[model samples]
Target: MIPHLWNDLEGTFFPESALDYMPEDRLREVQLQRLKAVTALAYDRVPLFRERMTAKGAKPADVRRLEDVRRLPFMVKNDLRDTYPYGLFAVPMSEVVRLHASSGTTGKPIVVGYTAQDMDVWKQAIMRSLYSAGFRRADVVQNMYGYGLFTGGLGLHGGLEGIGATVIPISGGNSERQIMVMKDFGVTAVCSTPSYFIHLIEVAQKMGLDFKRDLKVRRGVFGAEPWTDHMRQYIEAASGIKAYDIYGLSEIIGPGVGNECEYQDGPHIFEDHFLVEIVDPATLEPVPDGQEGELVITTLSKQAMPVIRYRTRDITAIDIRPCRCGRTIRRIRRISRRSDDMFIIRGVNVFPTQIETALLKTEASLPHYQIVLTRKSGLDQMEVRVEVTGDMLRDSVGEMEQLQKRFARSIEQITGLHTTVTLVQPGSIPRSAGKAKRLLDTRNEA
Candidate 1:
């Protein structure tokens, strides 16, 4: 296994990692200063921001303290849709150097731009993320994140190079090639979604390769979707590597918003560059620390597109307590649910992660599963189709029936809703190299 860059005794990753361990008072002061400047930039340059602020009778000058962030109007996904291509950008096209976008449910994609200075800050954030995850210059990292319009690939790619780590820019897919290259190059680290890594583990197993014995990879930085501790435990047990959760969105600044240190308790938000607030998704009121709510963010250093009070809709809580890693930045609970992904069935609210948590409890089932929703008798019905191990598949009918009943019981215990559990073969579920589509709502489909 490759050694991590972190120094346990010194409580620092390296000499340049001072910003992460700065005093809370000092970090807050820097955040406030940057917040004021970013708000002012948006108010002056973006008409949408100006009109929204004016309607609320608030200006950048009104931002006297950090709490004044509430005075600023909230921005949502529609704000980006209404603006289209560049409506929310704070800088001119001449100054903007790059553009990245995520596919929207409707017409136009949610696009975000980055100026040269913005790119530098983004890279610095990614570098911090890598260092915090114990990545070092000596480690060979195979970046499996998709490149191009998506921000995951290039974001980590640039940071890996910036940190002097040798990178194989293998942008997603080609599972056999990915594993072959990993083994040949003696890759020590990987960056990708947890789902993809799990798929890789399965693929390696099928190819007669043991991750713990045949592979040299020791660390994995996974993000771009909400994963659970159960999934983490599965990955660690299956493949001998410490999996770290990373948080970010293209609207704010790609995958550098925050990341977990060696502690892996939760990911620490880069407070100096991005301001985080957990608010009640319904009322839009700020919630106290340790309480779960929607995660909202304000980009303080982004020059191209500085979003103000942008609601991320991710459900998580903040931990303001100091960490053993000595970083002053606060950490957020691992995101397992999204405000928009919840569906109520039989008067019970259900998130796919709840089902995932339940499905992972049994060793007989693989992590691959799908939730199928349909309307029958004007009522919603959920059927979870999960892939079971080959041994379970080859078991006697009586034994298989018992396993199915056990799975249904575990799921009901967690969700309080009974679901039809159908155990399929291992490779029955479609695998995705990017974000896994776990939900299928055919109720609305004709």
Candidate 2:
């Protein structure tokens, strides 16, 4: 179900090699035209944008080019929260067909309403992502990401259907059932969080299932959590499938925002649908191309709920040049860290994902660990409590000490911060149904 509107503009506004050969000035012109149309819509329809523009003593017409977007006020998550339920909705209730809400970890769930056309746009983006990942009509897609209010499962399902693939909507959990379905139905592809995929591999081994020989899966799209190249190699080695990294958030759209192709260089952003900008987190000014900073997005062609200059705390860089796969759309590097999630440990910025990468490379039997941050004697400290598995226990006391020292040194190398490594029994850390929250900051308690 490709959008008819997209097809109409395919050769004119969006060319196959636009990013590759299109001059920057020409691309900017197209973006400016779209920005003007969206701004006009915001001024005439959405009260939130109208009030925001008015408060700035600016009118929608004042935004005539891409540069003018900087003058427009930035939209933050708090704005959506203040509006609540549907206050920020641009279209009337009658036109809306679906509503999706954020996980609400920060506060109230930010609700977004979508019309039929908006849903089509979402499907098209997801389909584009899947196609970029090498999925085809005959492939059997096993969706392991959770379904429902969370966007992973349903969003990918829509895409698989769009691509004419046999979609097995096996939402997360029930690893045994997932394996059974895969074996019985000959599923060819799978999608889920990287952690869950690792867990499933462990379960498969325990049940005497050979991942490479038994499963028909040829590719796996892993996202919803940050992963490193080392983790990608591990997943590929375990599942006998080419692993691709996908990037998205419910705030803008679902998992189809960007995806890595067979080249596995980086996840290409669907720039024709969504415009991405990398800005200095503190100044909100655009950084030079390829510089790491916060990612800001604007929905260029959305009708139901168009988000403009929405700040995504995720930190990454953008490459506007053509990819090795010959796609002209800009590609975004895997997110290095989220600005909101960065912990200040003794004046150093620490990202939990980096620590996780370090841990995975340690080859320690510890698959589960928790990072607890506390202040003692007016100083900050990080305690990494890791559960020792059978592999680590096979070593003697001296080997265990060496493992601990090695981990501490690795942590220092990656995060540039000293960490206290505590070995614990397996199954000690709390489990989570959704994304795991590994960090516990008790600094306020001090």
Candidate 3:
């Protein structure tokens, strides 16, 4: 039996050498070919996609080059909502062997399906990402991502198992037990949201457990929310683990679109399976390489649900230069924010990440924070909720008030938007074992 690691070129034969090290010209040619194929598949198999392509007067033949993808209409979350349960599925429901869904906090959950072939591709992608993050078949990985409905849990679990890693599918929550199991099992790697990992550090410390002595963890895979580089540095220092970012969305596949290698640079995308494009969110035109824009993806190999020109709304840029690790596949900068996660406050568009960046720079501020958007009269108001350390809370009330003013000023200077800053005692903010809820918009409410 062949091992599934990417670097084990002698053992793994699934992902051909071409996907990673193919010349740029040939890579483009492969993308062009797959783009046409997926476009045709979506047009033929899914009615929602067919109507969308028809409305744009775009046929599969129109997508002959990498640049021609602009002709296809964009797929958004609402389109899946309109389709309901399995409306956008390319294959019949019977053919779909697996199903996954989004949180649906705003409305009906956006669901996705996978056939046997799709499952194989999904599994391979995850395994490749895990290898990219420096995990080996010998490593014991504690999968702390949520299990059901959410894709992070099962997505990481199957991939870890495929690579022959000792996977502890602990499945999110249970901070104390998480530390205990990680210690007793001698976990060497962990996969979870970056915030949850920080919470673990706090709980472990409160319980008088030290990662440097009590735990064997040395690496982590963090995703499901946009975190800043400061948070990465803090996680690395607190837990003594080399943290890596993994990117994916439920609309396309899940948790396997791209990942950071040992280099800790931008994530190398699995372009052979996913055709990626960066486009202006406002104009919907392709953005030049190295320019920040919204990410758009088309799944070339998926059978049950092939999405063409799906607008991901993620904010990042693509780097086409060959990686130092020798992979020629293009990579995307870590996602800083998403369109759904953005909100307008008094004419200023604010992202939670921007607030996070400001908070990280402010002294006496903990990593825990949230953004709230409320409608005051006819205007939108912004509020930043942050937690401070116990020592900061113990300071004089006047000093604490001064800290709030200074923090608000820093945010304004960074984001060019004034905000109401609210400080809480240590551990006051509710923590999450899954994706952190960073923003709450109530602009439409009375």
Candidate 4:
């Protein structure tokens, strides 16, 4: 059986690498070997890893199997912040081939280095992610996920090149031109944040561009933020392409940690290079199978800065079951929200995504919405401001009022909070080409 409905894509998917097809037992063996080697590297070269491991009563030799990774110390973003630029590099500056840093918008940027081999692994992982999303040599991929200091741009550039696709390093912004390139250049695929793609839909509509008739893109790889199925449907319908979710963090190997295959079941976590664990964010212990918790990852193949059980703070559940794509790697539930993003209002935990999911479900409401949290009269108030579609606008006032009441009920149903849903005119909500800002709490803004 071959996937040939879309032209001669006889082999759009790369041959399963040993990492992709290795048996579970053999994969575990490789993980153990790499884990032991990295543990030795971090313990011997980096004082921080050695001190932490020594304090935890574990030595490199003590970690004999993949299960032993739990005994080793956990690495947090603060560890990277504490080390600053190169404190955790296993190799010297001369051996390090590249450097990529986080935005550090909150505070100190977490820096990561890559040796030549580390870079090679990164390229391979990205290729795996692309292959799963149906990327092939014949496809021309537009790398729009930012470049420089941030790993999304260059990492994806190298990845598309590795997969033998024609790479377009257009970067971000210039929404109209991006759509123009897609129309004129015969661009076949795209990778960017889901929110940005939705914005592109708006841009295309404004340009009077018809995606199905005017675009050649067959599939899209969307990542960098948590998007609901409502968002996916909106993007797919607007772009006329099957949408796939990609998951990664700068601390890990970037956007290739996992991706959705054509099956689109879940993003396959590349367990061969990165060992993933779902754990209670508060307790720092592994969670039950198929349970939702924080995502923790340990870099088994990284040389410059191998992370051991680094707490990702990303909330997701490991499916434990294999994917329908036939890849043995375990899959992770789409990222719901980060633990830090979880805010309890009136004893009910709520994430901005919850509101987005609820609003997107309503046909009359546009995907653009904002959750404004404020303290008024000594009580926390949650108000969801959403845009109404043009059809809803053209309708009578009674119709709009009923839709608004429906949206309010849906929000209350999802977040267990009595809420206010304000319907706004289209284009009123700000659209971001990067990560969409969804939450604003006036109580904490001071």
Which RMSD values do the candidates have, in order? 2.8, 4.5, 3.0, 2.4
Candidate that beats the other on TM-score, 1 or 4, i.e. the better one? 1
Tens-digit lDDT track for model 2 on 309-407?
Answer: 899898999976666566556788887578887888899988887788778778732277789999888888999988787667754798888888877
- Residue 193, candidate 3: C-alpha displacement in angstroms: 1.0
Q: Tell me, by TM-score, which candidate is best.
A: 1
User: Which rank order by TM-score, best down to worst?
Assistant: 1, 4, 3, 2
lDDT of each: 0.88, 0.79, 0.84, 0.83
Candidate 1: segments with Cα more than 4 A from true spot: 1-5, 8-13
> Which candidate has the top score in lDDT?
1
Question: How many clashes (backbone N, Cα, C below 3 Å) per candidate?
Answer: 0, 0, 0, 0
Candidate 3 has its poorest 10 consecutive residues by lDDT at 1-10
What digit string (tens of lDDT, one per residue) describes model 3 on residues 208-237? 998888899989989878877878888898
Winner on lDDT between 1 and 4 is 1
Cα misplacement distance, residue 153 of candidate 2 (Å) = 1.5
Clashing pairs in 3: none
| TM-score of each prediction | 0.96, 0.91, 0.92, 0.95
